[model samples]
Target: MRQALERRRAAKAAQHLPHADLADVLAPSAVPEAPVREKGRRERPEPIPSRRGVAKPFSGRAPRIPNLPAFRSSTGQVQGLYPWLYGKSLPPVGAYMGVDCLTGGAFSCHPVEWLHRGLTSNPNLLITGVPGSGKSATIKGLALRLLTYGVKTFVLGDIKNEYAKVARALGVEPVELGPGLPTRLNPLDSGPLGQHLPTDPIELRDRLAEIHRRRITLLSSLLEVRLDRKLDPTEEAALAYAIKDISGEHDGNSQLVDPTIPDVWAVLRDPHPVMVEELRADSVKELRERIRPAADALGNMVQGSLSGLFDGPTTVRLDFNAPIQTVNLERMKGRGDETVAMTLACASNWGQTAIDDPNGPVRLVIRDELWRAMRIPAMVRKLDADLRLSRSNGTIEVLSTHRLSDFEAVGAAGSEEVAIAKGLISSCDVRICLAQDTAPLAMTRDAIGLTDTECQHIASWTGQHKGRGIWKIGRSSSHVVQMMLTPIEQELTWTNERMSL
Candidate 1:
């Protein structure tokens, strides 16, 4: 009993002892602290040990790395190496169009504005697409938007009267031309150019000569379009003599009298003795025979299906002060291409008067269905001249067509006319191509010099939405633009009212 009591006392004493700290209880064998080095001394880290079964990689000297020299080049040269390096945003100027779908940025463009800003080489633009692709709306939108910048629009030939509403919206009634229509355009009128002549004899003579030359050229072009053949040397000489004689008679009068086509017709019908001598003809009868074909071509304009249109002096005067002017040719739609082409030629000549005036306002000349004019080589030359003179006239020439094939359709595959037509396409720096069918895509691609990628994108836009097009500016800048319009624009530009019915 005494021994058991002693053992219990010992166990109680052990239980009452103080508890040891966690650090003291879990402490391992002691490790020596690292030695401190002197201020100037160097110390290296110890090497790591290898695993028992692992093999090490080769520890030889590393192969020498190449040290290449830096290359230097110009931005232009560098662009060839890295085309994307020059993909900068176009300057924010001119009309505020819409957004560039490719870059998700706003887009705005005007031919003349861009020209003044040095963004484009010329103030000529071409917009083409399949019908119902919103090309018309885009054109109207461009014209309406450009008005804010003080630029005016002149629709040289509105074949289907599509722009009549837009013209009316601008508070101007479009000039309507047809067989029975009272409106008459004198292909001979000197336009505003002949309104006032300078007092100096030299200047007066030059100005009068310019007027006479323009009339002669216009008469010849009209005849060529009607006859579908170029005038021979004799025909051209006789035509010039008749114009000069009429011009001389009119200039001698106390009152200024603008010569009419009837005057020209009468002279051709009866050859003057002086004109006969100038032509070295045997007699008046011989001169008449040489010019019979030319006379007949003019006679057609005087009495043929085009009778009463270009026969008289211009009945309706163009308002140069107006913001927009259009010649409505809707009545000529079913009259056949020959009649339409002749009328367009005459109208274009008449419109040239406005473009010739040095002091006239800068205008946007819209030629819709330009393919009609392209059908005739003479007309092609006339248009080419206008395009070349756009810079001097301070005008923006806008051409809209259904397809590029219209150019190829001008003449035979390799004819001069076809070549000129293609050159016309090349002259336009701003080419806006909307959605197109596969049939025309090949021609469009070749004519526009589009890449395969652009061709694919343009093909995909078909039947997707309206107003989407590839807006190629200058030589390098290109954008996939979605033209946005306001409610008023929607109403004015909508062409489906007939379809809705």
Candidate 2:
């Protein structure tokens, strides 16, 4: 009973003050004191050896090392380590930087907090973990900390409506995401190109060429559909721009939505084609001029999607959770197909932009999946990983997928080089493996090679509790460490104050 009481008192003191010493936190108990010994019985202390030279670890014993020098406090003439503070040296272990969610208690964890704090030291961070391994919570904590530090937040979303409440609570409006999404969002379409676009003509041309080639087929498809209609000259030029590719985003990204493609599309999809004379493109020559403007218009729209994928002062949270309306090549193309294509263009564009701005302050650029846009393969596959490792952009990307082998879905039929499937995982700076049963194990093996080391790591990973995960900080290193997360308050999970001023 007496020992329990002492323990309770110490815990109470720890709750109120995070850095208090254990001895100081507990009060004296009213136990009978042991009788004092006689002077003659005094014993000399034995000398202890320095632990630095020790080879094998002494199991169950803390590693020994040379003690840090002691000091005295001049102010109070205190014979202690803290020469400036009545003094005593602070214990080496720093307090935990975690907040308890349920009780709203601030907890102290010594070594782990040291590592957690280390993440903020880098401009780019890639957090990968199984579903419950605290990845979401940690990012949230980082966001909350960043806000206090005045770092702007943006969530590039693939999952619909998930981040809306979180975004609103954090004082930023989430880019609205839902079904029947606007075929083109204007600010999203042109904003990035207007501001941070690369100035080098050669580089600009290359980027434009890369993007154009990837979507050329899709753009042309849209063009053929529109050539069936007749529209004004401006619209015709826009249509041409969309059908063929321009290397640079020379026109403002906003120019993509020519106010022509939709208008032309409206004519083609008109409820009464006889009533809408513009819907009548009776000859191939007439179709040729009219199609130019619609193509140019569609091209601008594609460029805009790229703009939305940036890591500027905003977070892009796209909802991928929606029922994707896959483009049916057999049926007529619709607005749904355009929206999906636009989403991919935005993802591809920002990913490339981040590559160009690798060391810039825009820390992380996350797009849920890189494979959904079919155009990426028959065309722009190189950009996906090239942009991933660019240090200057600090664009740490995240691809949220239920299957760990998202990369496997890509690759040419019967391609002997499995590297095509291995490419995405290989580029990631971090890989977090998570699952209840076999899914996570399978993902780890597929993403990284199914080597013996990863196999053992997965076996170990499966044993962890929720919110805990195996963290692989780099690809070349086989070493993986498990992390146990303390409860994190959703609202306080991400704070800007933790970032540099």
Model number with the top TM-score: 1
lDDT of 2 by residue, 345-364 (tens): 44444334323332334333
What C-alpha lDDT do the candidate models reach, one value each? Answer: 0.83, 0.41
Which parts of model 1 are misplaced by more than 4 Å? 1-86, 249-256
Scanning candidate 1 in windows of ten residues, the lowest lDDT window is: 52-61
Measured with C-alpha atoms, the lDDT of residue 95 in candidate 1 is 92
Q: Where in model 2 is the C-alpha error above 4 Å? A: 1-135, 138-153, 179-184, 195-360, 369-394, 415-421, 439-443, 449-454, 460-464, 475-501
Q: Backbone clashes in each candidate structure, one number apiece? A: 0, 72
How would you encode candidate 1's per-residue C-alpha lDDT over 1-501 as one tens digit per residue?
999999999899888856777786688356667877789977787666443322345643334545789999977799678865426557888898888876778888777767777778998999999999999999999999999988899998899788999999999999999878888887777766676777778887787787787788778877887777899999998888787677664345422456678888899999978889988999999999989999988887788857867788888867778999999988888888878888898888888775578887788889999988776677887788888888887788899999988888888899988888889887889999999998999888888888787888888885657999988888877788899999999999988888894
Report each candidate's C-alpha RMSD, comma-separated, in the order given.
12.9, 18.3
